[model samples]
Target: MSVYQGRFEGRCAIVTGGASGLGKAAAARIVAEGGKVVLWDLNADALAAAKAETGATDVVALDVSDQAAVAAAAKASEAALGKVDILICSAGITGATAPVHEYPLDSWKRVVDINLNGLFYCCREVVPLLLANGYGRIVNVASVAGKEGNPNASAYSATKAGVIGLTKSLGKELAEKGVIANALTPATFESPILAQLPKSQVDYMRSKIPMGRLGEISESAAMVCFMASEECSFTTASTFDTSGGRTTF
Candidate 1:
């Protein structure tokens, strides 16, 4: 038997960026614990692969940055798995690394659109559903960079910081309504996103972690699963750090 042991039995969860990496890990764990999950991602092929890997039939190919698409995906998830009990906003991007003054406007916009704006759109659409059902857990995947801004990655850092702020605000707003919002900050997790980073950038990230190693995806997923579970009811609007001692704040 799993340690979670039906902790989320019969619950419905939607994991954005579920096509790969930490998102997929979370989805698999949720399903293993008896919760139904909808995997939402922009890559249809990756979504299909994740569905197979996790045995999740409810997969939606939609861009999280599009408000209409997020709303539609929310509706589709409800239809497929009933009301959402847990929402994990894991979709994000590691934008080009450049000094703030040299960063392209488009790159910054794209990062903000998907990382911060898209997360809000998902929350906006899902919170009501949770409120109607009288229960929900939302875990936004942020990063340590959001807390301690990283050099040459202003856009990524700023967007994640926005997510932290949004989570705090929403957590307070829904404190008495049975819906909780929280954010997770994982540092230098071993994932596909790291592959896109330049060698110098990657080394910088790795060196910043006091642990001298990158965090495991499963370690981060464990924190996410705990936050999403009914057992984590008392905490809200707080940021949980699983950054291998990289985050002292």
Candidate 2:
């Protein structure tokens, strides 16, 4: 990938799930463009690896599902970075795949807690910081499954749908402010997260994509960088598609 020397210069970004997958890709992109980034994830080992790989400005190991932890991290971020200009909520999990009737209650709640509530915590804690600075960009990672539900993955689908909805509402609320909110609905991608889904389900998702292949992390990161940049001005509460033709709307 070519370097983007100054697109994000003078900016500080916070990327949840920065230890791996799409979040790591986004963090790497921002750092490549001369931006400072704080990596937040539950895995300390992966966080260390990402810091080594991406040269992120800082790393914090915490579960975003905990509102108190999120608040603390937000405070720490302000102390270290002085201000936050970008937020990428990429931390999530693919909960167990089963029909709604057969889905385990525990699994269902776990998915909602981590995927939906966790994102809310991050946004709630960070948006105020952004408002204080009078400038910010928020990129929430939804999924094509959110737009068009996939059979047998009710919990995962529902939480992702909620993410898209939340982005829209938050964007509208912050419309007049410099901070903007947007969502990205990507199809299946080549990432460790893919291992969580059933083989049959993974194959089924890929087959539905016109491209006939999983998306590359670079593709998602590229679009996210643009959305997290100043060029994304005037486009808030919008859902951007990176579904390889799998998403019609």
Candidate 3:
């Protein structure tokens, strides 16, 4: 049973990275609250699992970094859902943990491709569809590291920072177009993505949080739902925080 039943009675959403982690959490909430959702991820098996777990209406397996794929996904989602009301971009990577001098150029490019360019592609393809409907909400998942500049993770930090900038620019452009956009900046959170990093890297991130804890996946999902809600009106081009007191701004 959902506490906020029917908040999304007729809404439809596209949740990128919906196979797991934050994206799956958000998708589950949307479904529980009476919304239709389409899950998109890079893994077909994982996407299938998520679809069954969350009761999402559909799933699309594609890399967000692929522009043409994203374009086709937008069309497919529009066709399947009738109209897209929300876009939650939570698909990203941590890249390799290394000092700037030691960071691999290929790894940096890969991070930028998925974290920044991928988001750009999603927003680019979806915004026009939203504009046609005259209503939409977009929540791009960023990171506190983007603002604080975490040590030895320059690639992840720089690309996440780019996500913030991208959201801000899109929000402003859509201000008068009945669409809203924002970035969610989270600190060290309990996510599968964290597993990609060394334990020491994860520990360093947790140490920076005043609460000395990783944020629960549900906590971040709550914020994503709120930002994706029509109730979140009057706030665009802003960043919402789930940094466990690590970030006050």
Model 1: per-residue Cα lDDT over 2-101, one tens digit each: 3588888989999999999999999999999888999999999999989999978599999999999999999999999967888999999989989999
Worst 10 residues of 3 by lDDT: 1-10
Per-candidate clash tally: 0, 0, 0
TM-score, prediction 3: 0.98
Backbone clash total for model 1 is 0
Q: How would you encode candidate 3's per-residue C-alpha lDDT over 132-235 as one tens digit per residue?
A: 88999999999998888899999999998999998999999999999999999999889898879999999999999999899999999999999999899999
How close is every model to the real structure, measured as TM-score? 0.98, 0.98, 0.98
Candidate 3 ranges beyond 4 A from true positions: none
Clashes of 3: 0
User: Which stretches of candidate 1 lie above 4 Å from their native place?
Assistant: none
Q: RMSD to native for every prediction?
A: 1.1, 0.7, 1.0
lDDT of 2: 0.93
Candidate 1 vs 3: which has more lDDT: 3
Q: Which residue pairs show backbone clashes in model 1?
A: none
